[model samples]
Target chain A: MEFNRRQVLKLAGLGLTATATPGLLAACSNGKPAAGDGSVKFEGWDYEATLVQQNLDKFTQASNIKVNYTPITSAQYVQKVVAEFTGGGGPDALYVYDDSLAAWVEGEYLQPIDGLPGVDEVYSSIFPGNAEAMTYQGKRYGLPYYTDSNCLIYNAEILSKAGFSKPPASLEELESQAAKIKSMGLLEHPIGLPAQLSDTWWAWVWGLVFASGGDLFDNQQAPIMNTTDTVTKDVLTWLQNAANKSKVLDPASLQLLPVPVDNAMKANRYAFTIGARYALRDYNDASKSKAAGKMKMALVPSLDGKVHGTISNTRMYGLAKDTEVKDDAFKLLTYLGGLDANKQPNTAKFWFQERGLGFAYKAMAKDADVLASLKKFADPAIYAHLAEIARPRNVLGVAWYTEFETEMHKVVQGVLSNQVQPSAAVASLAQSAETLKKKYS
Target chain B: MSVLTERRPLGDTAKAWALNAPAITVITLLVAYPIGYSFYVSLQRNNLKRPKAKRFIGLDNYKALFSDDAFLSALKVSAVFVVVVLGLTVVLALILALVLNERFRGRGLLLSLALLPWAMPGVVNGLMWRTIFDAKTGALNGLMLQLGLIDSYQAWLTSSTGAFLFTALAQVWNTLPFSVIILLAGLSTIPSELYDAATVDRAGAFRRFTQVTVPWLLHPLLIVLILETMNAFRAFDTIYVLTGGGPGDATTTIALLDVQTVLTFTDFGLGSAYAWVITAITLIISVGYIGLLYRKGNFEV
Candidate 1:
């Protein structure tokens, strides 16, 4: 049958409505209301996801609250989570990086746990540096997932072969020892540190600077590392010389991330490198590392050999500001980052015992089980010593820290690549920080 | 009666519009709204991290971009990247298209294999290149070692020039197949009569290629140039995976910088300004290509 134009138009209109109606209805429908059934949604960067699920299962069994856990890729975790939060849907509780805490708090994506149950105990138990890292503008935002300080990890066999029984105690000694190791044909560029242009790159720089007793910013958030006599300058100069002039630093470090640097250490390609204390676990895991059983952690070398310190970092479990199941979410947060109802640091113990993850709890340092587990992959004494001295970078407290970190990565990269002198690069970074601070303020 | 052939009353016109309403609405919501919203966002100091401080800042974000050293450096990097990738892709694609257009054994298989890189995702392509160019265990170094080309493994991605070249080459590998297909289609459409006439007029092979082939393929080449330019400008996944705009700002394209600003820094206003700048650049380049290749409503040399 031949249809008239008007009839065809009417038929098309009906078909179009028919096609779009379901989608429109779905868009309007709130598929499931959150927080009504004692359930919480948790997210974190992917790292031993099976273990996370097992712990979540334990939490669910103990608390009688169901949890939906999702693991995002670590590299894109912040971007993906921020996008979800911006779009008005995100997990109830999620992992928060210490460096990103200030930005997330400023963005109002996270809620303070200042008045939450067991929060005070959680704060009092963990290391003060980690607690400070989680706090922004006088309010605590989360509890620690794990905390670690950057330590100088060395291949003991390689260093012994190069006629060194102990790790270098100063930056000058590190360079000279690295040069001897290189000259002996044990390894080319015997020092390895990740200088890749990433947010984490600043951590390595800050760790070295802190080890040398340099302050990047004052308490008032003003730049302080611009002067030539500062340890920041000394650290930057050493890094530049190691990468370019002395050539004891592997050029590949400029392209490597933390894991790759660890892998390089495992392969015994370097006599020394700076990595997180926890990475010592993987570095000494015989099954995973060829250099296992020979790797040892040393204090991060400094300029004067008098001050010994490193940059500490923490990853915490934070509550989303808009979480519907606030109580359940807090329970999950406490379970993962603090103590459970039994007052036992079950999650922290599990992570430390299983993965050799550093614990934020000060008590964990003295726990027999934690010490025994630490001895399996790392030296408990060195780990304890580094923990005692490690301090989180002061810049992390500022809202402009992320932007400053990005600029810092560029400046550090510029120094490593020999595009600019360390002095000029440090000055440039200070300028960048001041500009960002002013703009953000 | 056929809908196109039949005359319609004004009431029927209303019916036509009513029928199109759903589509129009969908387009408005999905396409137009974001563009309009982004323009408004670009004009404000809408840093997500500083929500309380956000306010209407007019063209301040755009003005700041002119002085942003990172953004300016990214713009330069993007310019070099687009030029290098486009030149390599168009030239190599034309050569491949010309070769594949000729009758040969396994030509079908060759064409099929040629499309494999294009079929691979950008991230995968990047990973593949990264493995090949990796400093410690890369196959390139291993091959060079075995062949006695170099005594030691080299850090290929460490140098700025090497990183930029390898990244561009990876992009070219991913994009060349599409251009080849386009040029091949254009080649098929080129009437053999033009080639025959050129040959009959005593034009040599090179002369025939210049006189007949080049002129005939201008439209397809124009499409390739415009598309590859935009693709190169907006390339993120491959570069992000490969080098992450690194070593120093060696490979940070405007697109990478834009994402870093928006997501990493959480500065929506500045990021939107970056997005608009990229869009404007892409539009200008596209229009320039069109005008150069097409004139008086027809393809021209």
Candidate 2:
């Protein structure tokens, strides 16, 4: 006996009604204000209120313009902006780095601000050679707001105790000093390195690589790392052997902030380690450590026993592609990136370091207060040292950085763990680099 | 109209198909479309900066991903992460659930408190753990020293193994509450009469637990296990916020890798491919678990 169609319809209706209804899902709760009329929605990370309020107040007082700020942390900033872009509500202004700049550029989430007043001037001020990299397809995507260069932060007390009056002037001298500190039994770590599997490890290692006169990639977008590149091999080998032979590096050195090498240095557990200049302020701000006044900085060793080089990175500002107020946004960029902005007495007095930002404009860099901070705290010699030898990170386009960074860490880890030789690791890295160049480029 | 028996009845096949229509429609729109689109993307050389250069090259992404050490390491770490966190969470949750199920004066408060870890936002929870694990000024090391448990402060999240272990601990702590709540609800459904009958039969506590409680709770246990396993595999925000998958790629997971690919690298094709790979694995595991449970009558209802 065949069933009738009406019976089937009734059965289906009963089954549909029997299932439990799904729960009402709420939207993600962390919502900032949307891009509003007469106000630009800006997203940044780790910008404290007092400093930001002061800077904003001054900018507003000067231009009568207001910005609605939505702050996130450095790590979350990229994710948030990407999400916003993906969702079609990206911020009108963003803070981005050179490493991840390609990501936004590739996504077409940014607008080139070439015609904006003073962009070209702002671009020219940032250590001349670095400017061309910020331009993509003959258009300026971002203006350099501030730049960073890594150098050696040493414990003056430890150095004096070990009979060294100043930081090492060469890689051989640096290693010899590290060994001397180890021999004195005054320190547990001679050098603090970035071994931690985070964003800064590549940055930390790249400095050493550049100082040794090794290139991460060549101009043709091909992998330059091969077994024959002795400089690259030497750099990786030194990091591994330093961690082992010197016995000054803590087993947990990888997990530390580049600055906290100063903490160990302060405690006399380490004599020297690589750190960013901005971190010098962090060291000064630390109330518990004893090395505040006793710390000194120097550049990483270069080839020829000449002035050591450093790795320089710039954080730039850009107008959002979809911003409603192109003129106002450019006005803000001009104020932030131009000489007029840095020369504002209030910008120096109120927001200078309180905002935990460094000076980018030539005028600001030479300001009496800002210059004092750089001269007294940040090593003057190292800045010059980096200027002479510093090279930008390998331009692998956007998709290639993650792979390159991963392979670099593995190579370092392999050497440290004794699982692979440094030369072989370079060979492996070359293979990874080759794969990336072929697939992505 | 004269005879109601003349009306036709739809067959079981038609009825079953009709019942599934809404779900099928929703799944196709929400899940299938994106998955299919991403598969198309994975075969292309798509860069966000150069949209004009997008070109289809089949299987290149998959080939590239295997040779990429970071992607491989991320997958391995993710697997280890899921297994270790799940093992820790399930055992701790069961014990807590059993303890809370007993009659007590502050039972209601205890039950809510047990579930509090699950309620905290992921980023906040991660930050709190990060501070506790900080080398210079973490509460954990400070307290440990005060208590004389260890002489020096250990960098809990800095070394390869240390970061891996502690990140797993944090994940377990964050997820255990959910497991406890689910198991507790399952415990509620067990009849008191069955236990009373067991007592009359002179059955010991262990005997009663094994015979009655275990069998009765099996259904909900299966649900909890499957859901928690999937949740654990997809864990991102907590680890990303806490460790950023570092002292170097030590804590990187497939989800975090997907993030780096999409946001950091702007290799959407590769990122989407990785996402699809994870989703496919999850689907396979869920189906396999359900099949096993059904065959064993663990979820007979």
Candidate with best DockQ? 1
Tens digits of per-residue lDDT, candidate 1, A187-302, equal 88898877767645456788888898778888777888885338788788888898999899988887787778878889988888887888888888889999999999999899
| Chain A superposition TM-score, candidate 2 | 0.84
Alpha-carbon shift of residue B179 in model 1 (angstroms): 1.1
CAPRI-wise, candidate 1 is medium
Candidate 2 C-alpha lDDT tens digits along A1-441: 776999999888777666533221212234433555687676677657556555666788889888777777876677677777755777778777776677677777788887777666666666653575466656788766666677777778878988988887666677788788878777656777656555544666777777766776676556666744567777767666666666555655655554455566666566677766666665555475666777776777654456355677766777788787778877776665555744352343334555335444444555566656666555655555555455567563445666577667756765654456777877887887787667655
- A225 Cα displacement, candidate 2 (Å): 2.8
- For model 1 chain B, where is the 10-residue window of minimal lDDT? B292-301
Instruction: Provide the TM-score for each candidate, comma-separated.
Output: 0.93, 0.78
Task: List runs of model 1 lying over 4 Å from the truth.
Answer: A1-33, A199-201, A340-342, B1-23, B296-301
Please give the clash total of every predicted structure, in order. Answer: 0, 20
For each candidate, what is the lDDT?
A: 0.87, 0.71
What is the Cα-based lDDT of residue B246 in candidate 1?
84
